[model samples]
Target chain A: MDRRDFLKCSLAGCSLFLVGKGLSTPLSSSALAAPPSQLSRVEARYYQKLPDREIKCELCPRFCQLGDKERGFCGVRENQDGKYYTLVYGKVASLNVDPIEKKPFFHFLPGSEAFSLATAGCNLSCKFCQNWEISQMRPEQVRNIHLPPEAVVETAEKYNCPVIAYTYSEPVIFYEFMYDTCLLARRRGIKNVVVSAGYINPEPLADLMKVVEAIKIDLKAFTQDFYTNYVRGELQPVLKTIKQIAKSKTWLEIVYLVIPTLNDNPEDIRKMSRWLKAEIGPDYPIHFSRFHPMYLIKNLPPTPVSTLEKLREIALEEGLHYVYVGNVPGHPGEHTYCPNCGKVIIERYGYTIKKKELSGNKCRYCGQVIPGVWS
Target chain B: MKTSKVVVITARNVFSGQGLPDPRVVLKMFRKGLELLTGASKAEEALAIWFKPEDRVGIKINTIGRRLLSTLPETSITLGLWLGQTICREDNIIIWDRSNEELKDTGYKLSNTPGSLKIFGTDTRGAGYTEEPIVNRNIGSLFSRIQAELIDASISLAILKDHGLAGVTAGLKNYFGAIHNPNKYHDSHCNPYIAELFETDLIRRKHRLTILDALKVQYHRGPSYHPQWAENCKKLIFSTDPVAADAVGWKLIDELRARKGLPSLKEENREPVYLFTAEKLGLGQARLENIEIVEEEV
Candidate 1:
């Protein structure tokens, strides 16, 4: 439809609400709160101060060199008066208590709840972003709740959550706040898990690894072209992050959303699985989630369930042990089967643990030691 | 189909003694530029070509740079007044940016009087972004309701500055204020996204004209102001073809950089290549060969 006709319809929709107040004076809303402002005085590591007040943001592969008062590509970190500050530090836009299974960490404590939080702004602009309302906005543009580090730990304790999950939007954008919160949560014996696209530089990732317990990287696609066109980022750095996690003590899991025409080729899936087996070993779980048509990518339809099942078959055929399907509530692919005994060990139905046949960390049916952090 | 004509009008005394835009000269520049571009004998005739008496005209200004560098109040007010006198009523014209705070910082009175010209921001209480995303090409953004719903027509009255990424911040880049996520499109020097955004029905179909306020141009190291690199070019550019207008603005910046013995935008690896992308999409002519240059002194 034409914009004019659409606008006319919109105005007509609001006409009934306009009757309460005269159009002369606009209603007053509350003034914006600047308490958790962008004045994060925390000293940033992994950056070099250039000549003439410009600083290169080495926290990501983009390495955006910004001038005074300019923000980096993330829209969260800014160079204010020649220093970098993460704008979304302790500025939570969305917070909820979700099952650890929802983060899809089949290896971690299955039924436990993780206190999840996300802030405004992301490092990359994915065309099919499900959370674009918050992720692709400046901190000032969104309504943020001030949940500082201590409050975060307190909230987790209050909810009886054993873990704090940094999920929803990109956690790398709120690096400082997540780092500090991880430290606080760790001291309180609360485990920390990160659900990220894993688009970060090495030095900062190393620092983050020292605090968080488990990391779930959403490897968006296997190709650099897909990363360039859809995600507005580079694929190499994300691959680097996965390799880094494999080398570290942190439990690592990978999620790849299979968007039908975009990134769901069986050959590419086979290549990625083979690469993962060679580099990180086949123990790490890889979830090929279903992609919904969202944000700018509404022209295309969602990935077919059969396509996801086929891709799962390809990954398994390529010597990967733990391969699963996501976003489909009750498909048989959601269950974890023992590679040794071929029996269903963990049956999942939409983030809920329907059945568990594991005795401690070993398979109850076959007595094979499963490669997972099943406490 | 016939292509649109773009006019470039310059004035000698665009800057007043206090070292900002002189309102009187800016009005004259807008008048003559619009008149010549639209091929109208009078200023009112040019304005009547696009707008009607009952229209609510939105003057979308750029104020992200705050007070130090922004679309000066004088240029925007002069256009608002001219628009108020010609096609729309005074109250139907609104001068706006992203926020009331930025507007206040850039020296503007926040007004919403019934019969007077209204001035406010997109963040003004009831005026936030649209809940749904407008999906077009690779540009998916929640438009500010002020631009998408509040007004009937839009005038991109923007500052012409050398962008640190886009190479030029003129009329086309000004529409970034209308969308919620401009920071995301800054990659690859804002190539296809800038063009694709302008092609969106939210912007392209409603955009009536482009007026670039270039009285004091920040030619280099910009989008932010450094007084040392600023120059008083004292000019305003008008066009219906948005790409052509920005193309001229890019040339002007290159000229300034050359005069100062600095590198060209291409040499610096930040050229405004988005114009070519826009041209390839059939938005407008970006090359100098196709654009008919018109220079007038007001």
Candidate 2:
């Protein structure tokens, strides 16, 4: 049924106890507020139209040349009878009012709550995909709530959330949703943050940087071999994205999921840390998150706490400023430490921010100016 | 040593001038192929070796490419009817694939008649994939209810075509439809996954036959229809051994490719290595010499 009929049918609610367990509800006239036809109709900026109704999506490094009725590696976007269409435009699969620390964006807006939203589908088929229930599915396979761009901003404002986070499933798959949401959020004086896998192309990445406030890229692994064998993607594009985001006004942070044996190699971590320090400079926070066996890659054990700590030490030794360990609830590494004075600037436990030892942008302990969106 | 024979039967007039396949000729070819492959005097006797009269048989057809390049409805329906008439009850037969939409695209009329032949797909609301995963070797996927539940025995009635990734998609690769996630198995040129999926109990226990519809072989740039490469070879291959059947199908694709002055699949670096993997897993014979192919015109 269409949205209008569905709304009308919902309003004729009776006190049917058979529906039981407080199942039946009467919809107010305002509850049927036309369901908001909020579409993120931003013309995709990085696709080249080819002859015979084909188009090569330059949005990501996959460079998917799709024929009619075909989708890119990311199942959300489709070539509908020759025209390219993002099926997940404004299709919100999951939404939660999460603290900024939950996005593990420890450096960016440490204590503030962010309204996070995600649509189904992802570009890379990582065997150890955490959000496979949504990310690995087609847009139609998931239950989508109609939280369009305007509605998203309004919800954030309603919840007193300062930031709107495009997260959970890879935001790159729902590019149009996140992009337009960022634009709307920006107009409403709300910040926009994106959690991505950094698998996007330069052109789209450049366009995204214009509206979004911060972007946290999940660098799945350090080597190309791991990217290919495990993640079904390339590491070069991620590196390129890091370089591009570093130049942009958008605040950039990188999250490296330290999977045991697969990518927890100290040598690779050291090299990655050095690259981050050399290229993006030390201020950009690199998260060495713990990995649990998930999806297809369930054979290996989770990364040991020592391994994450060791990686964190390596990053710090490599002159990285804002390195953090994630997924370990009460670990000391979860807190953000000041680069100069080596004091806990922001204490965190899992998604919760316990304390902020910073006065404005500077650490209260040693008056060291920590580089992030501190207010 | 693996003891199995693959029979290939071809008929030039399998398709009438109206572009629809003559079901009678196709049925005759199927019978001939089965009889020769099993060294049975009659096709029904050969079928009796594997299938019981009470078995609910599912003829799994490839319909992803739609009518232009798919296992034609006429061919599948004919096989289903023949199996019903000669081997089992009409009500006990089901010609199926992944989705109803795809079945319709390939010109199949969906049926669930109580006392007549039925045609449906896994995406039939009540007949979705099995909720739990069946893990075997490199494969971990939820098999379609049509494959895992509804049918007692399975027949992979596939269309012979060149694949962009797997070199060739034939009888064994056709079982990709039996599982919910064919997309995941496409990695590594469908190496161990293809072989392993066939090893799953839902498939390996129930699968009885492999019949490749080589009536119109797409020699190159295929699995999708590119008219220039399509050839109406007018053939149907049948075998109890799934790997041997696909091995013969691969040889046919290679033969066509070679005739067109195209490089061998090995030279093109896209050979269907899954056959060898399947052979190693004891699914069937992958080596060309092990399969006794009997080619005949019906």
Isolated chain A TM-score, each model: 0.89, 0.88
lDDT of 2 by residue, A28-121 (tens): 1111111112323334546778865667888888877755555677877766555787877766666667778878787788778877778777
- What is the alpha-carbon lDDT for the whole of candidate 1? 0.83
lDDT (tens digit, per residue) of candidate 1 on A1-375: 665565455334233222321211111112222322333546566677887677899988889988877778777787777777777777776677778888879889998888887877789888888777667777777656556787788777876989999988889888889999999999999999999999999999999999998999999999999998899888989999999999999999999998879898788898999999999998899999988988778778888999999999999999898999999999999999999989999999988899999999999998988877776
- Show the lowest summed lDDT stretch of 10 residues, model 2 chain A: A27-36
The global Cα lDDT (0 to 1) of model 2 is 0.80
Chain B only, TM-score of each candidate:
0.97, 0.97
Report lDDT (Cα) of residue B264, candidate 2: 86
Q: What are the clashing pairs of model 2? A: none
What C-alpha lDDT values do all the predictions have? Answer: 0.83, 0.80
Q: Please give the DockQ score of every candidate, comma-separated.
A: 0.30, 0.17
Fraction of real interface contacts that model 2 preserves: 0.02
